[model samples]
Target: MTPHDNLGYQRLFDDGLSFGVGFPLTNQNDTMPDVDEELRLARHAESVGFDALWARDVPTYWPSFGDAGQTFDVWPWLTQVATVTDELALGTASVVLPLRHPLHVAKAAATVDQLSGGRLVMGIASGDRDPEFPAFGVELSDRGTLFRESVELLRTVWREDYPEVESSWGTLDGEITLVPKPTTETVPLLPTGYARQTLEWIAEHGDGWLFYQLPQSTLESYLADWRDAAGDTPFSMAVQVELADDPGDGPEHIHQGFCAGTEWFRDYFSGLNEMGVDHVLVGLQSDDPEADLSRFADEVISPRS
Candidate 1:
């Protein structure tokens, strides 16, 4: 069977246009989240009908970068999340391919998928953090090449048992097998943000495409290009939103998204679906997590989903 028939794909993309919460679900990220509270929000998101929960993989926090990576590591954190929620897709917003070994990634991913009962979607990327490249001893320039090779290696090891392969990292002499293959035929790999490859290459290889926030007209152009090469493969994008209390508040432009009211968001989602977007990763930027989460579910997600 094809990758789209996988349970995560069916749950996340087939039922209708689905909405998911990008993690650290609280916009009030002033301090590290309490474990209990974070898990509660995760479970809350599931109850409220979020299709998936995405985790970010930031290896070493660069203070100058203004990003601490993530409070917890991607695999263990997702494993914990898998324990708390039943149906939500547990995803890595992306794992940097150039930094880590593919065998390890495959093993960890399969483990999570097995534990999660086959609900995992991986977003793969050629990383962009400058300091990260040197620290990991990876050449920043060859990221695009490494990104392609990594993808090829992952598919081979995951699908072919004891497969003989020679790769940049090392040669697999077809001696040992990687255990706990993904519950699906293979994990769905969505390439995020071009990953230093041509759109044609991404369209040909990726299970789907994961993009970032874009202006409306630009999005239309991008999706048009996607359809030309990728055809019906799914597309997902992330957006930042500051939910205003008023139903008619301004659609004020923000960095990657908008500060808007519920009604405006509802219409915006509709426009997105019409433009061939299969899923949206909502980054809620408001102060009240519980309240905004529920409201978004009731308004934007309910009608479309």
Candidate 2:
């Protein structure tokens, strides 16, 4: 078996396209979520065959942004979910790399990776929230540099026991060591968006890519570019969906996704498969998420699986 077979999320990409569910499993857009219900839906997703459960890292809730993104700190929430579910991958749709200290991020991520038994896949970003930069005291202009350095730091700390390393962030003097290393050789890192880096840089460094929804034409174009730069590194995207009650309803554009019936989703996902998409993180909007999840599993995921 290869390294891909050893990592939970990587396994999902081995064969063909696999599906995952993003957090805030319900349609309730409130800043706070009913934690119990979210957990219930998460486990149900696993039981029904979703490959992974993704959480967003929103350290502060900017009212203007309009979504709190599962409304819980990603580390604790994911660790708790890991205890209850088996074999389902736990991911951070993105942890803002430039905003937080790379050491803290490294330690926390490794802790989760160890606790989850190698199930963690971190999706990192340079951050796009304008207000967050100043609040964190991170310069927006230097984010691209900070982002690159942070990635290097994370890899160095995780892969080496203790090595002398210096960066604008800080210095590791080979005296201190990060404990509880990842269960695997290294934790998989997928960069979200461009993270202010060129496509070639991201392709050369990232384990995978986490992208927002895009139109088919645009996505095809992006994938073509990515393949040339990254060669078979998995590419994943998120889509929001409101499953119409009718199985025949066609797709209608919605916020970053579409409102569609089961048949339409099936065909849509199939097209994605043909396009060489490795995985998709589905964000569902429904009054009854549990029922909707089951229906989606039976209709869309099952056929594709």
Candidate 3:
């Protein structure tokens, strides 16, 4: 499948610079979330012209790590969200490839893609959490190799119909098949955070890049390097922001993101657009999530769109 095959991919990159919101939609930064409230805000986001909604994969909560992403299983969470929202694209940002079997990932992803009407853009990664490695019987040293093999296997199974294949994870012959193919020819795979591979390798294999927040100078350099290697493949990043009530508040660093006013956010996203970032996943930090989402729509997303 080509880059434009999946609906989520097309919605994200084909449009110049689009906006999305991360899950939980709260500042508590804990595993527990008000599911009904999140669903309401998700639909609100789409109604206001956001391009996508991103969900993360975290099988276990490691408190020391300081974040439990939306705290729901990625597949079921995405499927449920898909049922509620008609046009909003759903993404995994991302699924840990080395921790799970490739066949499971392939089947789950295909199912979500089909159910969502081809809206799944899979963000895949080689996990970085150390404890998760041993817990899943995956060696830290072999994660890189496992990651590479998993990516290859996912693509192979998606594209071929009951084809013979063999890998470190397992093997498949013509006798067996993985059913319920993606509504599209294939789901778009965006490799997140290098996944223990070289830039060259990532550029060659990934349909897009999903990255974390970077300082302006650093991001410019990184984007330059990516453009040199990957050509027109899309680049995406996540930024944490707490939109202040005052429209003129300047940016102050907050963890991997910023606490700023809507005015500053407009300028910030405009700069990202100029820098060739195709998508930005906004993680809202607020007590009143619905109000924050509305303010973002009126002030940041509306003007930009």
TM per candidate comes to 0.97, 0.97, 0.97
Query: What local lDDT score does residue 228 receive in model 2, on the 0 to 100 scale?
Result: 94
Per-candidate Cα lDDT values, in order, are 0.86, 0.88, 0.88
- Stretches > 4 Å off in candidate 1: 28-31
Question: lDDT per residue, candidate 2, 114-169, as tens digits?
Answer: 88888898889888778989998988999999999999998888878877999999
* Residue range 1-305, candidate 1, lDDT tens digits: 56665677777788557888877876434346677878899999999989999888888776676654446788999999999999878888889999999989989998998899888899999997899898989999989998999999888877889999898989999898889898877889999999999999999889999999998999999999999999988999999888888988869988779999999999998999999999888888767788889999998788775
lDDT, residue 210, model 1: 94
Please identify model 3 stretches exceeding 4 Å from their true place.
none
Tens digits of lDDT, candidate 3, 1-305 = 66486888888888788888999876545757888888888898888778899999999989889888899999999999999888768999899999999999999999999899899998999997789999999899998999999988888888888889888997787888778777776788888998999999999989889999999999999999999999999999989989877899999999889999999999999999988999998888888888888899899988987
Which 10 consecutive positions of candidate 2 have the poorest summed lDDT? 1-10
Clashes of each: 0, 0, 0
Better of 1 and 3 by TM-score: 3
**Number of the top lDDT candidate:** 3
Q: Rank the candidates by lDDT, best first.
A: 3, 2, 1
